[model samples]
Target: MGRSFEDARRWMQEGTKAFLDAIGLLHGDDWDAPSGLPSWTRRHLVAHIAANADAVGNLVHWAATGEETPMYSSPEARAEGIEKGTRMSGGELLAWVRDSAEKLEAGMAGLTVDQWQTTVVTAQGRTVPATETPWMRDREIWVHLVDLATSTAFADLPEDFLEALRADVADKRGEVPEVFGTLADVTAYLAGRPYDNVALANGEPAPDLGPWL
Candidate 1:
């Protein structure tokens, strides 16, 4: 079955705590070290996640008030926010993450069910109901947690969530090949993420995937 707003709410609430805990493990040199993605250090990853919260919150605000606020004022402003975040110290960055996430949580909590069904545009320009906002944040929290390559990995995600991710990736691609593997392996392959527990299915190397959605 597909997920609902309540499920997405649960995901955001639980996942945010775990994501914050995972990030809390990074220290001095660890923050400066490279993350799972090239050209992005751990600090950059932290900053991006923090900025994403506000961006997603913008959708919630639009839904509640029927305003036409885009996720960012402009593409350049988005990049600038992330760049500015990188300048913060570790303690400051952590606080920003906490504050921004809490602010989003409050916005989601204050919204009515009618407001949730109202349409809003995502950062990528797809128009979806406000209910999708929570799932969007859920994707960011879980995916980026693993991207940090700290105490989390693709295998750590629940099978159901992995299936959802796989479905999403396949949907985004229009069509995905039939690959028989564990949900984690299949999801990792489709999402262009790495998995420590990955196994080759029948000696065939997995097909190269594009950038992660």
Candidate 2:
């Protein structure tokens, strides 16, 4: 069976805590270091994650109140927020991220069964039920934790989550690689990260995959 709303919420909570713990370990210079993502420093990534919680929480509010609360006013506004967030000091950034995460958790907790089923628009312009919010946040926190490049690797993720992620990526990417390894390795490769451990069928390296959602 696929994951339920409760299951996704639990994983989202766990992933949030793990990501925050990893962020807490960053030293003075470490915050400015380049993360696994191109053109984004650790600060930029954390800020984006923090803002995402607030944005997704907006959808939850819409679900509960039937108000039309969009995640961001515009795509340009979203980009501006991230750029402005990068200027915050490390301590400020950490605090904002934690507080925003807490706000999102509280919002989700207040959702009733009916509210969970209400349709809301995602930042990507897709209209999905509020129940999907948890899984959306789950994917963001879990994947971005590794993208932080703070010693956490795909191997550290829960095996079940890795399996789900692999299937999801495969479905979205349309072409799955023939490489073989643990689900974590395949997931990492599919996520557009270099995985030295995966071996191709013809004894060559895994081919570069296109961007995933």
| CA lDDT, every model vs. true structure | 0.85, 0.87
RMSD of 2: 1.5
Best-performing candidate as measured by lDDT: 2
Where does candidate 1 stray beyond 4 Å? 196-203
lDDT of each residue in 1-213, candidate 1, tens digit only = 477678789888988999899878878888888988889998999999999999999998999999888999997988998898889999899999999999999999999979989999987889899989999998888888888878787778866677777888888887666666677777888888874443455656656767684
Clashing residue pairs for model 1: none
Model 2 stretches astray by more than 4 angstroms: none
What's model 2's overall lDDT?
Answer: 0.87
**What TM-scores do the predictions have?**
0.94, 0.94
Candidate 1 lDDT score relative to the true structure: 0.85
